[model samples]
Target chain A: MGGPGNAKIEVVLVDDDALVTRTLSFLFAGEDAFSVQLFNDPVAALRHLEQHPAHVVVADYLMPGMDGLQFLSKVRELHPESSRIVLTGYADKDAAIRAINEVGLYHFLEKPWRNEELLLVLRRAGERALLLAELARRTEDMAAFREKLFRALL
Target chain B: MTDAPGIPDPCRALFSAHADPAAVLDPARTIREQNAAARASFGEAAGRPCWAVHFGRETPCPPCRAGEVLQEGNALRWMMERADPAGPAAPPGVWEVTLVPVRDAAGRVTHLVELLRDVTLTLGLERHLIELARGLDLEIARRTAEAEQLAGRARELQAAIEQLREEQADLLRTERMAALGRIVAGVAHEIHTPLGAILSSLELVRARLAAGRTDGLNELIDLLQEASERIRKVVQTLRAFSRLDAAPVERVDLREGIESSLALLAHEMHPRVAVERAYGPLPKVRCRPDEVNQVFLNILRNGVQAIRGQGTITVRSFAEGGVAVIEIENTGPEIPEEDRERIFEAGFTTKPRGEGTGWGLAICRRIVREHGGEIEARSAPGRGATFRITLPIEGPL
Candidate 1:
């Protein structure tokens, strides 16, 4: 269930396991504000996002084609405003830290995750995206105002 | 205000009297006067444009501070390279220049006075000092690299010397073992023939006494015969030990060596302890019979000493791959893991100081290695210990 109204936050889930993807999709489907898109192939997910950007991206750390960090870096290059989260079976603290530091990851979830925790994190990420969108709009308005004042004075 | 400032009137006199190279020029870029020192320093062309006479250039230099002073009506001081015709064909000489503005009575700029002094020698000395510093840095680097190389060579030499010392120790051990073997073989061979004769004569005397029906004499003769046979067996064991050095290469039966070792230690074995042999059909391995028996004896003795009460020592042997394997397991307190690796090293023993010299295992390891073999021990804390020896079948007998 996305939402009753027209405003809905799109979330893209990228993992190599189909069962994991299905389980996460079902869990997110229970939320009203989220519309989940599942992709087992990271490359396909990246290609889909190039055409249709998502509000948030949740990826697996280990994948066949590309790893979670590499995928996040590519996603950041394509859409710098997208929030990225990594879900992994192994809790490699060093890799997680590196991923967060290098690629600007939003959060990380270890395997055997609870549905409530995943939903909570996604909700927080959606709220952050909303705040960033608002900030961007405000910056644009300020720039326009500054330009008009400069023209009148010059 | 009617008179020109600081230097116009007084500098003309100062310039003529100065010993160092000097020049005076007005703001219009024309040289007004040259001192004797300047004439000697720059040669001809005394009264021309300052740029042409000093720089050998027909045009004023770009962003010229001298020109800026004329336009802005301010004083300026800078250094420039002036062409020196009387000097060697090196680069131009360095000159310190000072510009001063002259005002008229109505407070208006009238003319500019410029004074020049040569400073080429000082700059040349500074360059020489920089070059000397660079040379010193290279020399220090070269010495440091040489010292490092020398240290590396010393380390290599130390390693080679240690290897040579180890080889010398091994050669000495081999020589001692070889000499002991020859001496034992000679003594055993000398005793064997006479002991055999004594045993035969004792048997003859016992036969005669039993036939003649002498009861007391028969018992004495029987005791003598048994003692003679015991001596003969001792001689046989000694001979076997001696033959280890000269034994020809052959596929030796390990079961025989183990049996002979047991027989040699039979008198020392306690009645409370039982010795068991679980031997398989092992292929004949190329080895020295006496040396292998010595290895078995040393391990068996260690096992017997380890057990204070009733215990069992099992000697097992089998062939696998291209090697012969023998395992001697004892039912006693196991060796600590920390001591297992160290027990095989030289001068390591658990026995009381005088009871054992700590050379038994060291010798055993040497002999085993000489035959291209390896021996290792395994033990748990509370369980018993096991020593396994694996010998390459293709090694020397």
Candidate 2:
């Protein structure tokens, strides 16, 4: 929702570890024409994010506040148009599985992620998020038109 | 001439010298003649039947040898009893009598002579031999019965020993199986956390190296090392525990066994319950290592379950009365006083169905008893529960 003149992509990173957030923020900072927000606490990130929903959310699996999967699920509800990326060390299989089915994840990021791999995943997620947002806008426009047309007919 | 037996004078002298009563009778059994010995024993017998003079019977005695002697014209012998003294009602003594018949030239039986001999002493000895034979038979029968009873008692002893051995083997098998289940679950949880951390650390390091940020590189490596080290400890402890199941009996440091069991359960319990150890110096206990390990596992598992979520578990070990003593105390809701007594009773369960709770404490009791040890539970409502196990340091009893 930033002005059309400022057409930069929006990305959000949430994790329990401050180091992971700082490192991931640095990794995504190079001239990709995108804005990155890092949150060490998922609760704080969610409160700020409700007012300004991001295009893509990258979250850690195990955290002191909430699990990665639960946070992403919450993100899916609040920012319906955002793409979800799940980060996990995969201590167990169920975490990954839940991230996919429960959180409706867009991508799986294994620990020790490569630079190129993360970027490629983020690029794809940005495009998908844009398309979903456009579709939602169109659906709302059509609903408003139907309501107005019905009132005029009356 | 002897066979002729006409009662000649020389034959009469021999009959008299025989020292036995003698008589001569015609075929009609009339006492036609009598010797001096017969006259002395029977008074007058001339012109009287032999039966009338000797037995005082009206006719000849039945089974009389006179008839046999007359018909066969041969000497015949018989035994009879007669009152020769004619005193008071005296018992008649036994006699051996022979009837000899005399015949004419035509071999006709004309007269018969009879002689009687007493044989009481020989008959008395035969009676004595029969009584001795009966007593020997009774002794043989009594000894045979005694031997049979002893054999039956030995068989009973053997059967009792066999039953005891079977019970011991069954208890050991159940305890071993329970230990394996608990170890498997604890290992899974223990391995999971470290593996997760290792994966995350490696991922972050890999991302940093691509961007040429060498700063804090050593810290990332250290995290990876620490995570893997945690995982390696779990593996080492599990391997040591697996080795114990194969050894039926061994000298075990009580502390090592308690630590091994705690490590296996630490994964699930670490997040839920706080643990503190107060181990003291102890002797090596001789026991079935796996079974002893099982006792510790069951008690610890119960302790973990008693704590719903946020509680403390304290494990203490010491030596008392020549026994290795272990105490596991939990700061959970205290068990009721009534439940404390029955905690180790078989088939007693407070856990809901499908939780596998009933046999946990019971199996612990069995293992301890089999090793010549003791286990007891003490608790007051809302205070907490403590299980005390005392095992003899000596070999299995």
Best by DockQ: 2
DockQ for all models, in order? 0.00, 0.06
DockQ, cand. 1: 0.00
User: lDDT for model 2, on a 0 to 1 scale?
Assistant: 0.74
For model 1 the local lDDT of residue A91 reads 40
lDDT of 2 by residue, B91-187 (tens): 3676677899877778787888887666666667777777777777778778888888888998998999899779756754675565565566446
| TM, chain A, every candidate | 0.90, 0.83
Docking class of 2: incorrect
Candidate 2 segments exceeding 4 Å error: A1-154, B1-164, B167-171, B192-227, B239-253, B280-291, B306-312, B321-323, B330-385, B391-397
What tens digits encode model 1's per-residue C-alpha lDDT throughout B1-397? 2222424565567757777655555667666666676666566544587776666676885535876776677888888776554333324778677776666576555566655666688878888888888888899899999999999999999999999889858754774574355334424323332343344334445555668744344444544455466567766765565455455556678777777666555533535458888898688888777677778777877887676667788989888898989999988888988889888886688887644556667777887998999988999876699989999988854
Model 1 Cα shift for residue B144 (angstroms): 6.5
lDDT score, candidate 1, position B150: 95
Off by over 4 Å in 1: A1-154, B1-215, B244-248, B270-272
